[model samples]
Target: MLTAKEIDEQLSILQETGRKISECFSSFGSRMDFKPSPEKWSARQVLHHLTDSEIVLAYRLRTLLSENQPKLKAFNQNNWSATLAPEQEELPLMKSCFEANRNLTIRLLKKIPASLWEKKGVHEEAGEMRTYDLVVRNTSHCLRHLEQLQKLTEASQAVKL
Candidate 1:
């Protein structure tokens, strides 16, 4: 369960992380390939993954805030990452999607009633999680990816010199 204040804080952190991610993408000198690593996603793929996750999670937040505890569907992130076409390295597209979704998430969090924060949803694997917890987790997910992107950028820069 989260108070409105806590939700607001999480929203702030999410928005800040989104901004940092955009900055990171903008800093890249050349378009990175989709096949940088066999096991790991390339920078472009990572951005695409984040965009997809943001869109899906934003919808989930809306549903959780608007309706009774709904049975949320789970997704296979690895499969999605592998299947999504990485034909273009569109940083602007990724940044726009992230910004729009994050703004919507912040607005939704602000609108959700404090009492409803404790509403429970059944995740396929994680079992039951409170709506607030889900939102918090989603924000944390963005931060984690942002960190990964930063590390990738640093590693690439190191290889240049």
Candidate 2:
């Protein structure tokens, strides 16, 4: 179980990471396409995926905090990624969506009672996870994808010179 302060700290880190992502994308001229070696998600695709996830997780957090619901529906991330087209290099839109969703999620987290942190949700593949765990996991997920984006950007830059 995580305290509210800890959750806020995690949210802050996520927001800072989002800012960094926005800065990095601003420096790019051409839109990157999803590559097979990188597991088929381009820089933009990854951002889109993150945006979709943030939306879902934000909803789940709201439900957990407000509805007293014990189990929320599971999501198929891979399927979702496959379904979303990668044409949009709209980094600004992606950043805005991420920021909005994250701010809402943080606000919801702050309002959630500490006693309800242990509420459980059964994911289809991942099995049962606590609401607090879900929030922490989402933060870590964003960090992992951000690192992937950084690595991809570095690799692309190296190829240019």
Candidate 3:
């Protein structure tokens, strides 16, 4: 179980990922579409994924806070990514959506009774997870993708428009 302070801190870090991602996108420009390897994601695709993930996590967090052990639905990220159109650069919009959704989620989380952090949910794939666990997992998830975005920007020179 995570302490309230710890959860708050994680939320802060998660919120910061949006700012860092935005910066990475701005720095990389057209190279946001660059793939370090054939199988890897481009920065733009990662941003889209983050925006989509945040949207889902927002609902999951809300449901965990408000409902009894809601079963969280899982979606195919690969399928989502295939449709994200990474070639179309819309970094600012994607970053804004990610940040705003995370902000709303943090506000909601902050207001909930600390005891509710123990609320249980069954993930479609991961089996049972507590509210605290979900938040922690997603916090790390955000950090991982943020690092990916950074790596994509640093390793691949931004292509000229």
Model 1 Cα lDDT, one tens digit per residue, 3-70: 56786787688778877866766776573543345787777877888888888887776676667767
lDDT of 2 by residue, 86-159 (tens): 45446778778877887777677667677767777666566777777787788788789888888778766766
Error of 3 at 84 (Å): 3.9
Per-model CA lDDT versus the true structure: 0.74, 0.72, 0.79
User: What's the CA RMSD for each of the models?
Assistant: 2.2, 2.7, 2.3
Deviating ranges (above 4 Å) for candidate 2: 1-5, 34-39
Better of 1 and 2 by TM-score: 1
Q: lDDT of candidate 2 vs native? A: 0.72
| Poorest 10 consecutive residues by lDDT, candidate 2 | 27-36
Screening candidate 3 with a backbone cut-off below 3 angstroms (N, C-alpha, C), the clashing residue pairs are none
TM-score per model over all chains: 0.87, 0.80, 0.87
Judged by lDDT against the true structure, how good is candidate 3? Answer: 0.79
